[model samples]
Target: MDGDLRGLLPDDAQTRQEPKLMHPFKNFQLNNAIFAAIWLVFLAAVLVQVYLGAGYSARDKVWMTACVAVFSAFYFWAFGSMESHPSGWSQFSRAMLRWAVLLVIALASVPVIKTGVISYAPYLAAMLGFSVPWRKSLPIVAATGVVGTLAVWFVAPEDLGWSSLVLFATPFLLVAVGVFSQYDVSRYQLQHELDLAQQRENIATDVHDLLGHSLTVINLKSEVARRALHNNAEQAEKELKEIAELSRLALAEVRATVTQMRTPTFAGEVQGARRALETKGITAHLPERLTPAGEHETVFSWCLRELTTNVVRHSGANTCWVSVNADKLQVTDDGSGFSTDTVQNREGGLAGLRERVEAAGGRLIVRREHGLTRVLITMSGDSELMRDGAVVQEASE
Candidate 1:
């Protein structure tokens, strides 16, 4: 789990101690705009109620409008603070205080003014529901409902039975909206995290494959150079120069990997596989060129690299053959063939390749027959071409 966390965080992100500054309108500009528009609509509703509702004089309407303005300001401040300072308890407490003040003012105006000014109580309940956790917000929602009911009862005790229903139902519906809104926000965040994790996995896998192959070849050449240093100066010099060239290529590959522009062609992989096989005292037979266009190139190149690596690391084979065409690639090795258990327990490199191939709308098949292990990969929607006595075993992604 700790390793997963480390992989999820970028190098710079892991090193940073302080919290990064969150831009207010970075990814959520549309959401913020919609929220602001809703607040404006609420404010307009308050003013309209103040002007049209009965039993309120000019002076009472002016005082009610003043309170509504202050309430809107406090609500905006609380909302903005929640976005900016999301972690600390101090900001949460301050926002809660602002909400409490708005509720108090709304409840206090109930006994004095017999107008729709009391409707703001439910809006405060909904805001609290949106801003805080459900456990903390539920009591506030209940209190707002009670306050609204009392205000309705005070204004017209004769109509209290039916009028009070509106007071309770309005806040209840708004609280439901707030809960669903928070749920949607949480779901979006989870999906974003999943995407980030998948991206990191791909990068880590590519870098590991790239470095592992290059370093293995480099180590082999270095050993050869050391062995020939005393007896043959020219051979040792040639090996040393190749090592330097390989190191430069490795560096370029790393840079390209970081920029997400490193695409290993099937031709390049075939050449690399041959060189790697020869270094390990294994003979490799490969085509002169295999030009698979579009997506096939990428999938086949990775399959070649993975198969070659498996041959070197897992198979005790002296001879290996690679065949590639437009739609299919087959790698065969006369190795100590894998048993059913061994294939089932395959992990790391082979497993990663299986996932890559399957995700590209293709199937990966491994077979152990006639003292040879064969790997066959074909793209989806391709015609099935039969090989002599080869039973295809498809791997799941």
Candidate 2:
């Protein structure tokens, strides 16, 4: 009666390739205009030279301005949306082409601006962070840092000549970009795995409960109809109608539960179990009143649904007993016994129930003693949870 829907759909996330995280620089990447405005300050020497006619003709300034404009626009677009771009030859080609463009601009700026290569070295290193994986980018970034540091030492800066701060900062910036980008990628992937695991667990539990109890009830009704067919035609006909209605309702429930996922109410399950047990000629001991369970209500509802289904289908009991305290639910039956094997081996819907309980920080136990079987569940060590009342035992065989 339980443990059947475990094969319906395997988690697709298990086989999925790690999703690429949003561009490592996504958070820090400013708009194109802003990025250019800030970095353009570094071009003060070139702009001053162009204004005063000190170094050369004005044409060099025109070329440098065009290059910076183009680089800033392309760099922002590429880095901000790297994650959305699909992977494969096409993506790699595009990434490489963009990196090459930036490298050309960086090199072209050197002789025109006379700041040496270190003026644009930092930008090139940032391009590497997005251009390739960290493993490849870090090594190249390290090389650029070493080269930049040496160039800064040998060539006097006609551009921003701040000295040692520039020397230490240049290399550190290169490596920092690579590390942070990789860190964002790793963090995003771990969060995705967690979401997938939680989704798989929810589907596993609901599918079993929704299908198992419904089918068991349908089977019980069929048996009732069969037994009454010859001796009581009117009763048999009523049972047939109920069987039809139940089938339709169960089908609807399966579809709805799968579509959005739902939790069944504890009150509804209690009533359902009562009707199911009555059909089996088993007397039921039920709570006289259902005071609110507040936050714990949903889990208690699922536990009752699973417990009643097992009792009606598996236990050959004359009387069914159920008790609820604040932190515990104990269902006892005068049947053969509850099988520990189902739990030990994780056999059926019972196993799904166990998972649901444990996920909510509760544990389930089943024991057999002197021809009576008892199943008890405790949550959060709070024995006062549902301790409002006791069950009113119905007289039985």
Candidate 3:
């Protein structure tokens, strides 16, 4: 029930490939832009103090304002370009350069900018907090706090007392909060991706199962209808109606499979394969009582159909036997069978089948001797076997 609810929700981010918009670069740009805009406004406030407040020397104020304006302009241009074409190294270099240049200028203007001893330290936190990783950002902010303290001790009016340490420490708290928040957001996005991938896989499996069974049924009923046409018109018409109904059901199954609401079962698959063999004039021997173990049924059932189809098309034999045990199944036929080289020429289906069976911790064997072709398939590790025996009586070759 919980898995159904999870499937109903938007898939978890960790499993799915998120579109490019959710990429880390996109998120970085947004956070960087916010921090840059805030810093720009803060610089403007500093400019106002430099010009109107009596704390700065006239010449020193002019130099500080020009330096800050240049830094602000470059900061905006760098971030804007990166937003348009985001490259990690370029963004990283630009961020580091922007913060370094701004920090240097602020350090130079400490005496002339005429704000409190710790005023510029808050801006440092805001800048690094948004752009750099927390491990790096924390140390940078901490160092800025130390510098702000020393500046207060050496440069502030000596009359101000030791209580001024509070001013230096406060901005670091804001920086710490911003860094932690960004980390949390990144983790949430990763989880969302994981959920989405699982949903897509489940949907694909459902589609394959639905289409495989329905198509086989349609093929069977249409053949029965065609064969009955020459013998009895009434029986032919009945088969045609059954075909129409089967077609409608197949369409409904296709739709449900697309939405991932339903999947094929072992019984349905065996029935479809049996019908397919009968339609093609091949005698199929399937177990009257058979049940698969858990999810292994879905994969092993597919193997049965593929193997049966190969037998009817490739082998020139009129008698076959299908035997299923608790853990394995075998198919044998009397036919003029080709060598492994000839099967290899038929597009590596045997090799692919081998891999699929091996992945499920099973084994497959194919050999021909004494005018008899035999396929011995064994599945261990708690998997129920599904097998079909078929013989081809006529062939173009």
Using lDDT, give the best candidate's number: 1
TM-score winner, 1 or 2: 1
Per-residue CA lDDT of model 1 for 1-397, tens digit only, reads 6556877888797767334344332222223323633654556765676689887689877887777777766565455445444344454474587677777767555544554555675667666677666777777778766765675677667867765665667767767777888887676556545645666688788989999999999999999999999999999999999999999999998788776535565655776786677656566767664344445988898899888888988898877877777778888887876565645566544677878988998887777766778888888655454342222222211
lDDT string for model 2 (1-397, tens) is 1224433435574334334333344323233224334554564554565556666666887877776767666666666444334343354455556667777777776766554445565666566664466666667666666665566656764433553444347635755765686676566556545644676688778878978998999899899999999999999999999989988998898787676435655555666677677656566777632444557777887898888878888888778877775677878787777568867678855799889888999988877655677778888664332321122232231
Worst 10 residues of 3 by lDDT: 388-397
Instruction: Tell me how far the alpha carbon of residue 205 in candidate 1 is from the true structure, in angstroms, after superposition.
Output: 1.4
What are the per-model numbers of colliding residue pairs?
Answer: 0, 10, 17
- Write candidate 3's Cα lDDT for 98-170 as tens digits: 6776677666765665434245566556656656677777777777666555665666657235424444455
Indicate the TM-score of model 1: 0.51
TM-score, one value per model: 0.51, 0.47, 0.43
Better of 2 and 3 by TM-score: 2
Best by TM-score: 1
List the global CA lDDT of all models. 0.69, 0.65, 0.61
